[model samples]
Target: MLAALVPLPVILPLLGAGIALMLPGRRRLQTAVTVITLVVVLIISLALLFGVDALGTQVVAVGGWDLPYGIALVADRLSALMLVVSSIVTLLVLINAVGQEMADTANETPVSVFNPTYLILCAGVANAFLAGDLFNLYVGFEMLLGASYVLLTLGSTAERIRAGVTYVVISLVSSLIFLMAIGFILAATGTVNIAQLSSRLAELPPDIQLILHVALLIGFGIKAAVFPLSFWLPDSYPTAPAPVTAVFAGLLTKVGIYAIIRTETVIFSESDLRIPLLVVAGLTLLVGILGAIAQTEIKRLLSFTLVSHIGYMLFGVAMGTVEGLTAAIFYTAHHIVVQTALFLAIGLVEQRAGVTSMRRLGGIAVLAPGLSLLFFIPALNLAGIPPFSGFIGKVALFQSGFETGDWLIYVLIGAGALTSLLTLYVIGKAWNLAFWRDPDDVEEPTAELVEEFEERREALAAGKAWKAKPSVPRTMSLSAGAMVGVSVFVTVFAGPLWDVSSRAGENLRSPQTYVNEVIGHGDGS
Candidate 1:
């Protein structure tokens, strides 16, 4: 019965996307289908999470073919948890997008394009999490990337088009690398099935294994926006519409991180790449936060911070211990919710103020206290303030590092601490400039800024799109608020969630369990 449900998370969204595309003219009906599909996916994910916990790993061989030849959909504790969180984030972002459309007649985002593409994106995410083979995972990445390309260029504005081009080129390069890695794995081990790779990979020459492992990391690292390879992200992500940006910020890189976790724990369990990963993690932490400190635009600032926090997850992966993996899982979950919430809150700021540049904004805390609270909670949470899930996850990671007692891990602990402090500083600076200072005190808009704003307004007016006045839509506000509430929920239930993460981490450490469940008790070959 449980195996029957494993594919629904991927299947239902694709079905809904098809339905939504068929009824493009019927926005209400399209929205209803999207929402109902996601809600069901969420419910199914929750069921899978509990079911996996109680029943152990659940595997489904597509079309009833046995593994090593057939596609497999496996849901264990980690994948199920990711499904649930991704479902929640996507659903809320959809609502926020819908609300933005309803409230603003001048909105450039087309519901016809957004809804179907968004559903396809969700399906791809689910597919990646539940994928049981390397080739299947590549297919999942393409699904999401195809949908994202359409979503990213929704406005067709010059800036968006330019950013989308850069995004697509970078993504394509990464995809090419990933495909090559898959080819190499298939050629070397004669199997791309993850379960079989667990055993077969170990038999190959050490140098060959190292080459394959590095190739996979480079591919996944670019997608995750780890520093030195993350230059595309800050430029690409901030150009999209608010809801699109929110979801992209929240889920896309995390999927890459999830893939990295799988590669480290499941396929190359005995590889000794810990020191290199640690060095990369330290660089990622420092460089990402330093970039954030230099940004003046709210979205761009958050984007850099997003890259910065990926290091924390990578830090856990580098530790290569059960405790470390547990913390990484917890931090990944925390960052997803908090980062999405922050982006959504920034969306509200953009809607109400018509700009996200800190230099052109002020007095929000006094004028829009509700919006202020919406931004504040998530901002603090993202900054790793105490009593929030961010703090809990970070502390867990630091504690795990301490337990390792490696001198290099000790240096990483210092880097993580500095990253947290800088994160707090940047968030506070944004709040002061955008919210606390009086609007009257803000510097006059530059001539170029004035021209850009007027051109945008004139374009909308010329297109018969300038109907609604600038104000936060009720639905948009509510959606953002609900996302904040979800972040808080993570904090409130940190104990239970940590337990689940611990269990998931344990499973990851013992890859043989994953192998045994998927392909029976013998060696996965």
Candidate 2:
């Protein structure tokens, strides 16, 4: 029974996507199908999480072919947890999108295009998490890239199209590199199955192993947006519609991070890439936050901070210890919720004010107290304020570094600390400029900014700016509020979640367990 549940997370969304596509003109029915599919996925993911914890790793070989040749879907603690969180995030973002469509008659994000593509994106994410082979993971990345291209350029505006082009080019380059790495792995080890590669990789020459490992890292690195490879993200992500941006900010890059975690822990378990990862983590942190401090637009700032916090997850991975992996898992979960919530909240700001530039936004605290509260909670949470999950995750990661006692890790600890402080400063600056000040005192928008805003408004709906309601739709606010609540739930349940993360971390550090479950049993027991 538990084994049967492993494949549904990927299958159901795909089925729903097809069904949604068939119901082209029935927006209500399409939404019903999409919601029911995701809600079921959420329940199954929660069951998988508990089942994996109770029953140990669950693996299902597709079509009953034996491992090393057939495709396999495996769910241990890490993948199951990711599935649960992702299901939750995707469902809420969908709700937010539905609300936006209902409220905005201009059809900024057409339901016909959005629903099916979004479901496909969810299936791709599930596939990536459950993929037990390198080639399958590449397929998952392609699924995401294909869907994201359509979603990113939804408006067909010149600005969005340009950003989408840059995004597609960068993503295609990364995908090609990933495909090459898969070929190299297959050529070198005679297998691209992760479990088999685990043992076979160790037998190859050290130099060959290092080359394969670095190739894989570079490919995944570009996707994860680790600095240097991160320049495309800030520009690409900020141009999408609010719900699209929210989901992308929250989930997409993390898929790359997840792949990197699997690569470091399972395939190259003995390789010592720790020091280099640490240096990269430090640079990622400093460089990303520095970029955030320089941004005036709310979405752009959040985008930079998104890159900055990826550093924390990378920092935890660089520690290369069970404690470190645990913290990385926890931080990944926390960042996903907090970051998605922040974007949704900012989406509300954009909807209400018709702009997200801090210089032009003010008095939101008085005008829209609810939106203010939604943004305030996640902003503080993202900055690692105490009593929130962000703080809890950061503290756990810092503790893991301290446990390592390496001077370089010590320097990273300092970098993480500085990054946190600067995050707070930037969040504070945005709050003061956009929320705290009186509307009358806000700076007037420049002609260029006004022209851009007008273009966007017109793109969203030809002339609806004059006819649309001034107040934000309640559904949009509720969706954002629910996301904020989930972030809080993570904080309240930090203890149990940490314990689960620790177990997942322990499982990751012990590659033999994964191998034994997938290959040793041979029947996918």
Candidate 3:
């Protein structure tokens, strides 16, 4: 019975995508279908999360085949938790997109492509979380990648086209690398089933195991935007529309982080790579936030901070302790909501104000007190401010690292703290420039645009007909506010979530339970 529910999260969204495609001419109908599909998935995902908590792991072997022969969809504690978070974020972003489209005419935009492609992208993300085999996971990645290409280039502007090309080329290269690693794993272990590989990989020579581990890490690291491999992200993501950027910023890289967590714990638990990961974590932290400090554009600054926070998760994961794993899981889910909310709030800023460039924008706090609240809360939360989930999550990781008592771990801890301070500094700088300062005090980034807006306002006030950009849409503010609400909810309910993370960490550290549930047996000791 539980197995029957395991596939619905993935299946419903794909079905929704097909249905959405037929209603492009009827956009309201398409959006209704998309919303209904996601809402159902969200309900199912929540059930799965609780269901797994009570009954342990649930597996659906497609077409009734068994073991390594079947395509399996497994929902354990970690995957189920991720499914719930991802579903919520996607639904919220969908709401944000609908609000965006409602503010403009369909002929002036591309609603036709956006609706179905968005659903497809949601399905792909769901599939990636629940995938139980390497090949199925690849299929999930491609599904989302294809949808992302469509979403990224939706406006068809030259800037969007250039960014989309960079995004696609990097994605394809990453896919190729992932595929080659899959081939190597198949040759070494004779199967791509993750559950089966848990045992088979243990039989390979030590050097071969190390090689395969590094290969998989490199493939996933690029997707996760770990420093050095993350150059494509800041360029590719910001060019997309606001809702798209929000979702990508929040969920996509975390999927890669999810893959890394799965690989490290389940496949390479005994491997000797913790020290190298610690170094990577430190570098990722310092390098990423430093880049953020140098940015003048709001979106680019957030992008860099997004990369920087990945180090906190890596810091937790690299420790390889149950406490470390717990912190990583908590932080992953926490950052997902916080980061998405920040992006959505920034989107609201871009709509309410004419520009996101710190050099040009000001007086937003005086203009929209509500928008100021929305941006400020998430910005502070991202900086690990107290009473918020970010602070709680970071503290957990710091405790985990401190327990290790290693000099390298200690140094990484210091770097993490410094990175947090720098995150606050940069985001504070953005807030001060974009909201607190008077508009006239700064040079207008786009002088002509500002002049035109001023003239239009003057004309309207003088009873003359003048076209002006529409006010921020109600739905957009509502959707972004919903994310802010969710972030607050995270803070309010941190204890329960922390408990869930602890249990998930326990399960991840002990792969035998996952193996037994998925494959119905484990390798003999």
User: How many clashing residue pairs appear in each of the predictions shown?
Assistant: 0, 0, 0
**Candidate 1 residue lDDT tens string, 395-414:** 99999999988999999999
What's the lDDT for residue 512 in model 1? 93
Segments in model 3 whose C-alpha atoms lie over 4 Å from true places: 102-109, 445-470, 521-525
lDDT of 3 by residue, 56-80 (tens): 9998888667666888899999999
Better candidate number, 1 or 3, judged by lDDT: 1
Please, what is the whole-model Cα lDDT of each candidate in the order they appear? 0.91, 0.91, 0.88
Report the C-alpha displacement of residue 260, candidate 3, in angstroms. 0.1
Residues 1-525 of candidate 2 have per-residue lDDT tens digits of 999999999999999999988987788898999999999999999999999999999988887688868898999999999999999999999999888883123346666777889999999999999999999999889998899999998878899999999999999999999999999999998888899888899999999999999999999999999988999999999999999999999999999999999999999988879999999999999999999999999999999999999999999998999999999999999999999999999999888888999988876675667788999998999999999989999998999999887999999999999999999999999999898876557687434334444554676686444333346778888999999999999999999999999999999999999999999647532
Instruction: Give the poorly placed runs of model 2, Cα more than 4 Å off.
Output: 102-107, 445-470, 523-525
Which RMSD values do the candidates have, in order?
5.4, 5.2, 3.3
For candidate 1, the clash count comes to: 0
